[model samples]
Target: MTTTIEILNPTFARVSGQELRKAPFPRLEEGTKVRIGFLNNQKPNTQELLALVESGLREHYQVESRTFFKGDAAHPAPPEVIEELSRFADVAVLATAD
Candidate 1:
């Protein structure tokens, strides 16, 4: 006997990646300290990866980080998580280790 399982995924109409080019990077004053929010995409080792990236950023920039959010395996960062991150961080690094 054999068994089969099905998985469903959300779909969106395809869009050109070029559309992203119009967005600009956020501006910060020289020497402005940056708070980085680290998001885990609910994957194994995500926290460790985020920590390493945070460490690297700290070595060169005025940086701090908080692991303030997590998401299920199939979803990206949640809106609430993003909102919270925006409140505390100038930039964010999302990590996934599947």
Candidate 2:
């Protein structure tokens, strides 16, 4: 009598995927009437940073801006917040600081 052992083979299959692409963001134009959104994640110094940016944009560009503060910096801004910003503002500026 003879005993036989089965051999198992392992293989890696490629996942269904496409090539990664660069992020798509709208360009801010000068001398154009636009609305900008400033997002504060509630982190320390983030509000101050955004405030500076807000004033600078106002001074340099012909644009309008609105600020939205996220309750917690640890968590991402919710979809509703993003949707509202998209609807209300032409572009968003997210700021974080240590």
Candidate 3:
């Protein structure tokens, strides 16, 4: 009797090596009004941590910000949410809490 063994990959994969299709958005310009968006991954204490960081940032620079919390951390932020942030924010800070 002969037996054969089969191997399987029981794992997920990540996307990579994509080329940019468009130019990146410009950085915050010098001496210009700045609007920053803070995104929280809804992990424990992330909001508190971001708030502290925001406070520290404000101490050094005059800027505005809006805070957003993702519905779930395991998945990426919704496309609409990202679009809205792009329209409203000049820069974004994504927070991931371990």
Candidate 4:
């Protein structure tokens, strides 16, 4: 008797040829206080991970952090949430910890 097995791939690839572009963020001056915005992906342990990062930043630099939940990890964040973060933070971090 012979047995057959099938393997499935659950990976995503970019099929388009268009290259991505992004503007470089400005450098911060020395002694400047930094405000970091955290976008939680609503995944397991994502909040804990962000908390640790926030703690580290606060210990080493003059940092302020604000966290916003994105409701669903599989969807994009709401425009209002992005706008609020943009107004309050100099840099943003979107974390996903499963």
Highest-lDDT candidate: 4
Question: lDDT of each model, Cα atoms only?
Answer: 0.73, 0.78, 0.78, 0.83
lDDT of 3: 0.78
What lDDT is obtained when candidate 4 is compared to the true structure? 0.83
Model 3 agreement with the true structure over 1-98: per-residue lDDT tens digits: 99989877578576687876974565654545678799889888888888898787676556798988678998888888888888888778865847
Flag regions of model 4 displaced more than 4 Å.
1-19, 29-31, 95-98
Which of candidates 3 and 4 reaches a greater TM-score?
Answer: 4
* Per-residue lDDT of candidate 2, residues 53-87 (tens digit): 87888775787888887768878788888888878
The residue pairs that clash in candidate 4, if any, are none
Report the lDDT of model 4 for residue 65: 82
Please write out the lDDT profile of model 1 over residues 13-44, one tens digit for every residue.
57776545543456766556888887777577
| Winner of 3 and 4 under lDDT | 4
Candidate 2 at 62: error in angstroms?
Answer: 1.7
Per-prediction CA RMSD (Å):
9.0, 6.7, 5.3, 5.8
lDDT of 4 by residue, 4-67 (tens): 8876656857679877889556477655689999999978788888899988877766888899
